[model samples]
Target chain A: MKAKVIVKLKEGVLDPQGQAIQQLLAQRGYSQIADVRVGKLVEFELENVTPIEGEAMLAEIADKLLANPIIESYRIESQ
Target chain B: MSIAVITFPGSNCDRDCLHVLQNVIGAPARFVFHKETDLGDCTGVLVPGGFSYGDYLRAGALAKISPIMPAIHRFADAGGPVLGICNGFQILCEVGLLPGALMLNRNLRFISRWVDLRVENSDTLFTRHLWQDQIVRMPIAHAEGNFTVEPETIAKIVAKQQIVFKYAGPVREDSPDGNPNGSTLSIAGIVNEAGNVMGMMPHPDRASEAILGSTDGIPIFRAFAEAAQEKSRLEYSY
Candidate 1:
């Protein structure tokens, strides 16, 4: 099994890199874009853990290390 | 009464911090590798600036899981002095030893230059010999040094006088209100609730010498040494 974790800055947190990218897009005639945000994705390889266990483990890993609760939020997907 | 300078793999300023603590400040200091289990006999811990763990995942994120972190947490829980500079600041925050998290600069550029900082609170272990609101010059070198926190946390830290240093430079387009990294309320350094653990983005170790362009950071190092001596004294007397 493989799991994916998406870590993104919270809504109110400033994302300067995203803004820079958005500006470039607008310059290239993508001006209709409303907003842009940056985030990280981490893939994990699981051994024998069931879906329930994998979800719990990934949440803990994302909460404790992968994503900072103060400024970032994380989502987990497993298959 | 020595300060333990914890060196991570990518830590570039470990030598500079050790030099300031051991040679310039004349305080006993030793190097403790990242793998060290215990902090040994050192009274205080110094987390110097550098690209620890290559700033992967985020600045200071990877280094938070280092083996030495548990020992650091124990020392901090006991109210021992822990100072984190630049990358150190990020690591401390990642470990929840500090209040806020550092994000990319507002302009998204790495800022490296001398910045004027007003000593917001002189009563912290890291600012003992400094005066409140006294402007001091120090070099700041980091991109993810912009400090951010929830709205509620800011009030709590301000009420506790946790803000130690605030950039006092003139307002610039890149750094609104003169904060080089656009930190909230222009904060450059802060202390934890216990006031024993401190984290600052500026590199005081780089500014502790006159020949290096400033001596304003010398007193700050002296304050840290003084705090270490006090900690050692308390241990021996009891």
Candidate 2:
């Protein structure tokens, strides 16, 4: 089974890299872009687990490893 | 006094820290690998910088979960001083030894240069020898040295005098030339509530020698050595 974790900076935290991308795109004439919040996506394969167990285990792993509770949040999805 | 510099897999500045502590400061300094569960006879620990775990997951995330962290945490809990520099600072905050988090520079650039810092509170064990508001030059080389915390936490830190250093230049907070990473209130370094742990972005070890362009960093190492020696003496005497 495969899993994907989407890690995002928690709201209210400044996303400098995301802001830079927004500025760069605006300068390149992509005027409609309102904002960009940069984040990370991690993918991995789990061994011999059903989707239900994978979901539960991934949630725990995300809280403990994939995301820092202080600055980031994570969403785990089956891929 | 004996100090240990904890070396993670990618810690590039461990040797610089050891050199300063052992050769420049005249304290016995040694390395403690990340996998070691014991800090040995070390009275103080220095978390030096590099791309620990290649800055994967987060700048210091992987290193925070290393086997050595629990030992360091216990050491700090027992009132042992722990100094974290650059990536080490990130790890300290990640592990909750210190409050706040370091974010990417607002300009999204890897900053590597010297900047003047104003000593905020000189009453702590780390800065007791330095006078408050004194300006010191230190080199900061980091991409994620921008510090942030909740407004409430910031207020409490200020009230409790946990802030130790700030940028010193015209319009300190707004001037990129001063606040190199756009840190909150120009904060460059801070101590924990217990005053036993400190996390700072500047590389003091890099600036400890005159040949490296400044001796401003020497006072920091000296202060740590002095504190460690005093603590050890007190323990042995009792």
Identify the leading candidate in terms of lDDT.
1
**On a 0 to 100 scale, what is the lDDT of residue B128 in model 2?**
84
Query: Scored by Cα lDDT, where does model 1 land?
Result: 0.90
lDDT of 2 by residue, A8-69 (tens): 99999889888888999999999899999989998979998999999999898788677888
What's the distance in Å from true for residue B230, model 1? 1.2
Q: What is the DockQ of candidate 1?
A: 0.92
Write out the backbone clash pairs for model 1: none
| Candidate 2 total steric clashes | 0
Tens digit per residue, CA lDDT, model 2, B1-238: 5788999999999999999998999988899999999887788889998989999878898887899988998888888888999999999998899999888887778988888889999998888878889998888899999998988899999999999999776444446467778899989999999999999998889888889999998889999988777777235311
Best by TM-score: 1
User: Which parts of model 1 have CA positions greater than 4 angstroms off?
Assistant: B233-238
Place model 2 in a CAPRI quality band: medium
Task: Report residue B92 deviation for candidate 2 (angstroms).
Answer: 0.5
Look at candidate 1 and tell me the lDDT of residue B226. Answer: 82
